[model samples]
Target: MFLGKVVGSVWATQKEVGMEHLKLLLVQPIHADGTDAGTQVICADRIGAGQGETVIVSRGSSARILISKDSPVDAVVVGIVDSFEYCKE
Candidate 1:
């Protein structure tokens, strides 16, 4: 799993059969301290996460399994993050 923020959305007029109904979002991964970690990623939204909301993401086969065993999704927004605790050193 990874922590990220929903930065944007993706609109696809046409897509694979199983992917058509999924809401795609652009997420910017962030560290627990809330700093940008790297480049943004496109994720399938399952929790109705909106832009600017913190979210939890799952990648690879784990993400695919949420939709179906044969789902082609590589990443998914599995949960909307309510809060987090990060220990500072």
Candidate 2:
């Protein structure tokens, strides 16, 4: 999983049947301190996250399985991070 910020939403009136009901969001990866990590990704939002919210994104093949038993999603927003904790050495 990765930490990211929900930047915007995507709207499509017509799409594949399996992807029709899911909400899509443009997410940019971010550091724990809330700084941009210079990478942007579009993911299916399973948790209803909004813009500016810190979210947790599941990636790769497992991401799809996590959202649904039979989905083709490559990435998905699984949770919203209310607070972050990291041990700095």
Candidate 3:
């Protein structure tokens, strides 16, 4: 899992099998200190996360747990962050 901020959204007119209902989002990888960690990633969301929200992302097989164990999703939003604390000093 990783911390990320939703940067934008993605619209795909043509859907792959089992991917029709998933909402895709563009997320900028972030560290606990609210700084960029890596390149942005496109994630699949089912819990209604919008732009600028901080979300917890699950990757690989863990991402498929909520939908299906065989889902082809590479990333999924697991939690919508309400509040968090971080310090790097």
Model 2 bad stretches (over 4 Å):
none
What TM-score would candidate 1 get against the native? 0.95
- TM-score on alpha carbons, each prediction: 0.95, 0.86, 0.93
Across 1-89, the per-residue lDDT of candidate 1 in tens digits comes to 99999999999998887898999999999999999999899999967899899999999999998988787899999999898889998
Q: Per-residue lDDT for 1-89 in model 3, tens only?
A: 99999999999998777889999999999999898999999999999999999999999888877777777889999899999988667
Which 10 consecutive residues of model 1 have the lowest summed lDDT?
64-73
Total backbone clashes of candidate 2, pairs 3 or more residues apart or in separate chains? 0
Superposed model 1: Cα runs more than 4 Å off: none
lDDT of 1 at 35: 96
Q: Whole-model lDDT for model 3 versus the true structure? A: 0.92
Best by TM-score: 1
